[model samples]
Target chain A: METIAHKAKLSKSSPVVRKYRALIHHQQDMPVQPDISVKHLNKVYADGFRALKDINLDIEPGEIFALLGPNGAGKTTLISIICGIVNLTDGEVKAAGFDIIRDYRKARESIGLVPQELNTDSFETVWDAVSFSRGLFGKPPAPDHIEKVLKDLSLWDKRNNRIMSLSGGMKRRVMIAKALSHEPRILFLDEPTAGVDVELRRDMWEMVRKLRENGVTIILTTHYIEEAEEMADRIGVIRHGEIILVEDKSRLMSKLGKKELRLHLQSPLEKMPGQLALEPIELSEDGYELIYTFDSQQEQAGVARLLRTLGDLGIEYRDIQTRESSLEEIFVGLVNE
Target chain B: MNLYGVRAIYKFEMARMRRTLMQSVASPVISTSLYFVVFGSAIGSRMGDIDNISYGAYIIPGLVMLSLLMQSISNASFGIYMPKFSGTIYEVLSAPVSYVEVVLGYVGAAATKSVILGVIILITARLFVDYDVLHPFWMFAFLVLTAITFSLFGFIIGIWADGFEKLQIVPLMIVTPLVFLGGTFYSIDMLPEVWQTISLFNPVVYLISGFRWAFYGVSDVHVGISVGMTLMFLTACMIAVWWIFKTGYRLRS
Candidate 1:
């Protein structure tokens, strides 16, 4: 396994590395407790459609966990069950250390869900709508907290405006404001930036980072792979209602990520050299380039041996470039597998 | 007990009523006042007194009951239905609130609104006729009980309904006709013996009769039976609501 120290040496100032370091330091001081836990959870809809199979997951507090899946991969169903909006068929779910079924009030109180749909009370002022959400979680009226949440979302000026009068992005901000109103310990943002403008999307990402800094655990589902690449500390891929993979972002990249070396030769070769026939390399269609693909995590990458072999064989290369597979490519490969 | 959650839902619904004051409060008040004018003063003055009470005064309880039933169901149904329609009900469903608290907040607000409308219509009726409540305590009791019962009924309708048209189906086709035939403008005693017996089958007859008995100490049926029938309906509505929450019918999947 590649260690965090090894990854840190690769990029000293990477936010993902810094976050993992902070998580390790925090874990050493206190007993580790998952903010959300699922044990063999299963859900089947009324129409006999199995939305979720036996699944298990644990998300640490203050971590940004991203769930990546296709349209019908049951991401929303799992969230709804945890948030107590939908009924689970069997198994157990606990949030903030409370059983979601038995201690539902406490569990739900600790959670704030921003659903994928932009549902709001159109006739209500943004202030009332957000304050109402706080009250719904059984919290006392705290104008200062509401004010802070509004200002953080950049919605203070539109506080008195009816939600129907706001723009689409403003309405999206109102949804986030409402979710944050109660100061929940865990926040589930389901496609938070879907259909939002670029500016609002960036603002949402910043707010999420700030919330994480304040020790709020965030679990988000998104179709945007770049979003997961940008924000998530851990990535989970769900396909056909089953969790296929879960790993630290850096570890996943280092383990599954592949590197390709393309050597542009000075002279075209009709075919591979007889002596180099056993090498894991390929010739370009026009025989102008030599391509070698290798796992990034391998200790002996064989690049030095290949270069020495080229020199011994008098195979001249004018230029060489390497490329690593992106997370999108790895994700697609995983889903297809 | 999520009291704050209940209060939040209650206050939110009440604020919605306030926002549509002209429709929620004024419309019913004006319509009830019109009933007093047309049925109480205009046509009622030409009719003979029944049970030694003025025809106009005799119909006061029935008319109030009519408006109470309609408004209670309308207020509660619309209050809950709008949330479902706007897709905002997910918040209520996911909140740290029990089903009991949810019903208390919604039905409580609806009942409160209907009771206030009942009182306003009563005060407005004083403009055209004079009436007395022989059983003042029972009069208020019936008003509150009927409001609560019908509001619970409305809450169920709101949950059961899938579209706007379904919301009005029960109130328009079933409730309105029942009220019209249940003696809102005339006593059952004024009908033929055959029709009087048939009118007993209508549940609204018992509510109107009990309320009329509170006003004039006379009724088409015994006061105990009227109260019992209303309680029966109330209990049935309670059971239906309990079932909806327990089964998550039309609520959760």
Candidate 2:
């Protein structure tokens, strides 16, 4: 590490090397790396309502992380603590190698938050709002850069329009532009699609993906499970203010996920016979199909045993369908568990 | 605190206030004009004079003070209360704008409105009652000082209140009543000795006296004391605002 630092110092005069150095600092090799790390973070309001309880999470660099939870489930509280917008009752958080309390400026400069509400000054033009956000981070004016952000968010055309004139969706897009103004390494979107129409939702998703492509790590909290399923590289589920699980999306699905097996019967049976009744079978509404729901994580779903019992009961099934559980189901199951 | 942040937020706030310019600019003028008409001409026509000055001339300071206080309180409180109602406080809080920038931007804007209203009232008063400032510099100074002081008080009120109903509670229930009881229309000496002593407890008394002294070179209370009290209030309000911002107060935590 010392030699590498020495070598990098020798090449500082080169613009290419200077840019590389700007991205990362020379530190001794540590296997663990997190763009933002929250350690045992806790938040208790003055009224003694504990909003967050010992929540721990380490968001890796360049991953789109989705924090999924019900309302009042500490998702917003966690985000607020990480952004230094809320005080922590206890614990520590580091963003881009800066402790939030000790080095707030650097920690704050490293992150950008697009809030759920359309909170811009209504009288401000889109241009001034975005540019001023940049200045808040102690950044010098970069009009070309600001113009690019506006264009990317499709806001350049309305740059001069007052915020009050824009619709709810447009105001939300302006929020993303403001959050992006500082060019932070980490971006947080708190319910980025809440109350937004379908068209603007798609635009915001694409814009967020583009930001991620530019190497900005994105952390988003959403009540919509589909958003996390579609956009996130990793999923973290918080329940009752505690992080229950955080895992790679695919790996988690394969590990603790479930699949439902459905069987349609040829005959409409008013009631299940004794043999089949002993099995975990749910009858369909029309009395023509028998549904069997079991945890896929179990070593034996007892499909063979159930099949033997169905044969004995003379239950016929010409068609069979299998469905895997969705992230919604997974989330509900985890929260329940 | 930050140049770009302050300018950006300030420009945004100023623009928001300008959108409803008719209400902000016209209401104060009309309200003050009524005072000029009723109190200036009607009362002055009957009473003749006080302190060798016509009743019309005696009320000019009151009219200007009345406009300045109303504009200051409304401008400062609304500047913040709307954002809070709109749920945009989080955006501003999360943004790069420091708390100082946020408070100062609103207070400064409110003060701007107060100053403008004060000027309008002064000009309007001249049309009814003939009065000249004993010292124009002190006149302007007193105008700015009072504006800043009350705007800061309004800033504190904005942060403390949560809703539109709560926002108006302080100004309507407290400040307006004090303005009327602050000897705006008459000298406190005219009151019984017990009531005269009670009037000193009202902070608005100092503000009205200081402002009246600037225009007439006469005051019920000591000019130095009024200015000193305003300074004390200004410093105390600033400290409270700064502390709130630093601790996040009702804003963050």
By DockQ, the best candidate is 1
TM-score versus the correct structure, for each prediction: 0.93, 0.83
Query: What pairs collide in candidate 1?
Result: none
TM-score of chain A for candidate 1?
Answer: 0.88
RMSD of 2: 7.1
What DockQ does candidate 1 score?
Answer: 0.89
> What is the per-residue lDDT of model 2 for residues A1-337, given as tens digits with 9 covering 90 to 100?
0111101111123232233334554543434356788887888999999898887778766778898888889998899988878888999899987898887767888889988766777767899878878876667789999999999988899999988899888898898898888898999999999998888888778887777667788999998888888888778888778887777677667676776778888888898777776666788889898888766665265777777778887888889887888988888877776
Which 10-residue window of candidate 1 chain B scores lowest in summed lDDT?
B183-192
Docking class of 2: acceptable
Candidate 1, residue B70: how far the Cα is off, in Å: 1.4
- Badly placed stretches (over 4 Å) of model 1 are A1-31, A265-290, A312-315
The DockQ figures for the candidates are: 0.89, 0.35
A156: Cα error in model 2, Å = 3.6
Tens digits of per-residue lDDT, candidate 2, B18-102, equal 8777888887798789988898887677985666777888778876887788778788877777777776666567655567777
lDDT of 1 by residue, A75-97 (tens): 99999999988999998999998
